[model samples]
Target chain A: MLYVELIAQGLIQGSIYALIALGLTLVYGLLRILHVAHAAFFTLGGYVGVVVANQTGSLAAAIVAAMIVAGLGGIVVFRLCYQPILHQPPFVPLIASIGLYIAAEELFRIVFGPSGLTYKYAFLQGEVELLGFLRFKTGELVVVFGSAAIIGVLSLLQTRTRIGVACQATVSDPQMAESFGISLSRVGDINFFVGSALAAFAGVMVSVLNNMVEPTMGSVPSYKALAIIVLGGLGSVRGTLVAALVLGVVESFGTIYLGHFLDRNAIAFAFLILVLMWRPQGLFARS
Target chain B: MLRLERFSCGYGLFRAVSELELEVPHGTITGLIGPNGAGKSSTLMCVAGHVNLLAGSIVFDELDIGGLPATERVRRGIAIAPEGRRLFKDLSVEDNLRVGGLIHPAGRFKADRDYVLSLFPRLGERLGSLAANLSGGEQQMLSIGRALMARPKLIMIDELSLGLMPKMVDLCYDALLRLKQDGMTILLVEQNTDRVLSVADHVCVLESGHAVWSGNAADARNDPTLAAAYLGLH
Candidate 1:
């Protein structure tokens, strides 16, 4: 029974990781920005969702508000800090992203205070038995379905729309896309906004599961998502999704069976090292 | 038709092209040739709106388009197949063509893609293949095909014969002339003066960012003294 429950929990956790990886992969693939500040935006979304829900007593409003805030923050960061560094080397923007990340984290801390906050809603906390040995909470089940829905919608948008086509072009070659009359800045800004919103959605899922939120919650997940991106293959969405699922299952089983005392981070690092040494081009490199 | 009057452009104050004046009339091939660093590319970049005009004006179809952005210029029927073929290497050949046709209205992309593919049958054969995998000559054909998808009124090709076998260069120029006969206005920038002079209606020679000579291709071809002086061969 414990083993089955652990597997279920691991799947749910993997879904959240996949959400984070989805956004990270989009921005990294298109704009080639490390965008470390995205993690802070993720934490901000959770806090915002809880605060909005607590104030309005409406889960829908809370989720909308969280996505909107994170999306707007993404636009601002892309326009003000990152876009100007398009012609510069990679290191400048990366350092700038770090500074922005720290600034956003501090700002979140100041606004909501240093401690964690909880959403005392019963809808999320409630759980039901699926079978004699299997049980799942409302939030956990919601995470699974909600993530699938979002991913499905995003894939559709990427494949079918004009903006999606332009985004693919920009990711493939910004200069060539420009020659084709596609505005790199506009596509890049929109992608950033969308990616951040997705990250925010993932944050809300995490908050519902843990029943609490803190400003620093994004740091670990950010590293994990980056690892997922590297493992999946840079600029490859499908690869990131697979990597996220694999990471979630491995980490969950590692924590339970191998003991929580083990440094699970070593798993990510070793995987990264192996990937870099074996296939520096990434596992499913498009070009 | 494209015309540049007293066009000066550069990086900051260091002038790359200074007070250059030139013209490519409607449905005619104009070849721009110069020695290395004689500002052939700088002039093309300025006309394409990739480089800012430091002074003077660029008039494309009688509109002052010098101040427009690169993408905006491209949208206004100005297309440049930049040096080195600047392809979106990760994208499939079809996607690259689709991107080139992005400025067109929604209903026209499929038709444009078909037309461009027909122009370069090699690209049609490899439509689903990644562009990075294409050979250099194939990549050049794809670049030209991609630019053709834009349906531009005027197309500027920089260094059309660079890093290609002599036979491939001949084939490319033949294709370019066919495009010209199909009513596409062309501004050909090349270091291979002999080939360009063979096909151009008019030839303009630039030396150190200034137009040193301009005349009919036949006149320039027959006058060795004039050709030698203008081409820096004397």
Candidate 2:
């Protein structure tokens, strides 16, 4: 019974990780830039959700508002921070991203205060019993099912749509895609918009689960997402998904069994190291 | 249909092609022939808006498209089957064509794809295969077919016979002739002087980014000096 409960919790957590990491992987795949500031978008989403939901008293409005703000913010960051330095070495944009992330975190702290904001009204407060013995929170169910639905639609869009095929072409070869009349700038805008929107959605869901919105909320998940992308194989979407779920389950188990010596987050890095040592190319990378 | 006036292009500082004037009239095949590093590919790439156009104007269909990006140029009916056949290796052959025809309405996709398949029927059988898995000749065919998907008025092909079986080469050249018959303009760059001389209506020989020789293909074949000096024929 404990094993099943842990598995359920891990899978729910994995869904959030997958949502956040998908955005990171997409941006990395297109521009080869590590968008560390993505976490800031995540943080921004939570604040937006909390404020909107509190004021308007509508969860849907909060989600939509958060997505729009974060999506547009992501595009602005790309234009201001990444575009000018794109011609430089990869490290230039990466350093800029790190700086931007730090600045965003500080800005949030200044604006939202250090203590963070909590939900004014109860959200999905009840728990439901599953099968014969297990009980799960309604918020947990929402996160898992909502994330799964979003990912399903995204996968279908990537495989079945014209723009989706165009995105893949651009990823495979930008110059050739350009020659074929697929604008790289347009693709970049779409990628940043969609990726950031997904991150924002994850943020809203996490806020609903915890009933709190904090400036530093994104820090742990952001670094963990970075680790997941590398563990999955850089620039590979499917690999990142698998890595996220695996990391979630490992961390879930490790938290209980190794609580005496290791922290919950430390287990993620340790597992990453072990997996990389065994399969350096990543779980799904074509070796 | 396509003209370059006092054109100069290259990388940031190093000039690969200098001031040059060339034209491809409507419904004709114009060949650009040169040795390696003579800027044959650069010239085509510049026209396709891939390289830096350092100076001068690229007038296509009486429109000066010197400042347009590659995607806009494709919209204006300029397409290139670039050297190296840079097909999207991970995409299926069908999806590659879809991307090529992305600017057109979705309703036009089937017709364009069918036209490409008609031109290279082998692509029909392998539409599901990843481009990286295709043979060298098939990749070349798909490259040309992908360009054709845009339904361009002028199609530029660079290094058309670089690494293909002779039979495949013949098939591609035949497709060019068929495209010509359909009133499509062609700008061909090739090291195969003999092949260019065999079919090109107008020939321009570039040396160190200058047009060292320009005339009808007949005149080029009959001139002993040009034949011996550049065509590798005595």
Candidate 3:
């Protein structure tokens, strides 16, 4: 029963990780940029979600507001920051992303206060009994089921729609896509919007689950997502998902079993190093 | 019809084509034939808005399109099947075509796809397969077919026969001829001088980024000095 509870906790955490990592994977897949600043969007979403929920006292409104803010912010960042340096070396934009992320963290501290913000209203606060004996938080259920639904919709959009096909073409061959009239800029805009929105959603969920939102809240997940993407294989969405879930489970188990020797994050990184050493191409990467 | 007047295009600090004047009439095939480094591909890329046009104007159907982006150029009815057949390798053949027709309404997709399938029936059989899985010839065919999905009034083909089997080349050329008969303007850059001469209504022979000779196909074929000197034909 304890193992089952731990497994459930791991999966819930993994679902949130998957949400954050998907954004990183999408941006990396489209532009080959590491997008470290994605964490800023996540932080911004948490702030937006908290402020809106506090003011209106509605969770749905908070989520919607957070998504809009983060999605549009992503487009602005892509246009003003990443687009200009895209023609340069890959590291140029990556460094810019890191710089932007640091700047955003500092800005958030200045604006939102260095201390942190807490949810004013109690939402998804109760625990539900599941499968006759097990217990689960309503927030955990929402995180798992919500993340799965969003990922499902995203996959469907990529596979079933015209814009999705155009995006895929642009990803595979930008110049060729341009020759066929698919604008690379448009594709970049859409990718950044979608990816950033997902990150923001994760931020809101995390804030709700933890009942806290702070400037430094995005820092851990940012690096964790980076590790997950690299471990899953950069630019591979499905790999990122699997890696996120696996890392979540490992961390959940390791926090109890291996806490005496190493920290949870250390365990995740160690796992990444092992996996990379074994299959440098990544678990799901096509050789 | 498409007209390039004093067109100069190149990569940054490196001129690939300079002050090249050329014209492709409607319902005709114009062949630009040259040896390696003769700016054949560069000329086509410039017209397609892929390469930078340093000077002069690209007039397509009386619209000055020199400053337009590649996507706008496609909307104005110009498309290209570029060198190396740069298809979306992860996408299915049908998806590649769908992306090509992105500017059009979704309602028009079926007709455009059907038209492309008619041109390259082999694509119909492998629409479900990924682009990377196709053979070289099929890839080339799909590349051309993808461009056709845009329903362009003018199509520019770079290295139409390069890396293609003779049988595949013949099939591609046959499709080009059919496109011409259907009143589509074609600007083709080819290394196969003989094939170009046989099919091209007009021919321009480029050498070192300059037009060495420009004339009708009959005139080019009849001029033994021009043929032997530039066309490498005795």
Candidate 4:
């Protein structure tokens, strides 16, 4: 019964991780930028959601408002800090992103103060029993189901839409895509907006699950996302999905079984190291 | 229909072509022939807006397109089948073609796609397969077909017959002729001088980024200096 409960918890937790990996993979696939500020956007989303939900007392509006604000923030970051130096070395944009991440984290500190916060909601606090041994919170169910639906939709969008195909083409070969009349810069901007939006949503989802929000909440999850991206393969959406779920389950078990020595958060890195040592290219990375 | 007057282009601090004056009149095949590193690809890429244009102008339909980006140039009716046939390896043949025509009206998608299928019937057969799954010859055909889907007035094909069987090359040249008859302008860069001379209306031979010779294909074929030195026509 405890095992099943842990597994359920891991599945819910993994959904949020998958969301972060999905954003990382999406932006990395197109722009090849590390985009550390994406994690900052995650923190931004939590703050935005917190304020909106508290003021209006609506979770739906909070998530919507968070997505919009973080999405626009993504576009602004892309235009200002990222796009101009795209022609530079890959490390150049990566370093700029790191700088942006630090600056944004500090801004959050100034605005929200140097402490943690959580949302207060009655509907989100209740729990429901599933099967004989599994009982999950309403918030946990939302995390699992919502992440699955969003990921499913994103997968469909990537394979079915014109912009999605264009993004894939650009990823494969930028020069050829350009010759074929695809604007490389334009595609990068759209991807940044999308990837950042996903991060924003994931941020709120994670907050909803824990009933806690903090400026530094994205810090640990962001590292876990990097690990998840590597585990699934650098730029593969399907890989990220599977890797995130497996990781979430593993972390949950590790917390229960190896809880004394290894914290639940630290398990992500431990698994990442194991996966990397075993498969250098990741589980789903193509040659 | 396309003109490059004193056009100079290259990577930073390295000029690939200098003071190059060239023109492809509307509805003509201008075969640009040269050895490796002779700037044939650079010139074609320059016209397609890939290589940086450090000097001069690229005038098309009385509009200067030198400063425009690659997609903007494509929007203005210019396309290129770049070197190495850089197809979207993960995408199906149909999806690759669709992406090529994204800038054009969605209504013409079927018409333009049908036109390309007519040109390369093999592509029609393999429309559902990933580009990476295709043979080298088939990939080349698909690359050209993708460029055609844009409905561009001028199409520049780099190394049109590179790394393909002779029969496949003949088929590609046949498509080129058919395209020419349809009133399309072509700037074809090739190493196969004899094959280029066989059908090209005009020819430009580059040596060390300079236009060493430019004239009607017949004159180029008869010129003993060019025949033995560059074209190997003898």
Can you tell me which runs of candidate 4 are displaced by over 4 Å? A1-3
Q: Write one digit per residue (lDDT tens) for candidate 2, span A97-141.
A: 999999998998999999999989888879989898888889889
Of 2 and 4, the candidate ahead on DockQ is 2
**Residue A109, model 4, lDDT:** 87
- Compared with the true structure, model 4 gives a TM-score of 0.97
User: Per-residue CA lDDT of candidate 1, range B1-234, in tens?
Assistant: 899898899988889988888889989999999888989898888888777799999999899998888899888898988888888886788777877888888789889887776667778899888888998878888888888889999999989989988877877888888888899999999988888888999988888988888889888888888767765433
Chain B fold agreement for model 2, TM-score: 0.98
Give the TM-scores of the predictions, in the order they appear.
0.88, 0.96, 0.96, 0.97
lDDT of 1 by residue, A209-262 (tens): 788899899988888888888888887998888778777777777776565556
**How would you encode candidate 4's per-residue C-alpha lDDT over B14-45 as one tens digit per residue?**
99999898989999999999889999899988
Report how far residue A30 has shifted in candidate 1, in Å: 3.5
**Alpha-carbon deviation at B225 in model 2, angstroms:** 3.0
In model 3, the clashing pairs are none
lDDT string for model 3 (A1-287, tens) is 88888888889999988988888888998888899999998999999999999999999999999999999999999999999999899999999999999999999999999999999999898999999888888988998999999999988999899988888888898888887788788899899889889889889989998899999999999999999898888888889999999899989998999989999889888888888999988888844
Preferred candidate (TM-score higher): 1 or 3:
3
Question: Which has the greatest TM-score?
Answer: 4
Q: What is the iRMSD in Å for candidate 1?
A: 1.4
lDDT of 2 by residue, B17-130 (tens): 888889999999999997898999999999999899999889999999999999999999998999999998988999989988998999999999998888888899999999
Report clash pairs, candidate 2: none
Best by DockQ: 2
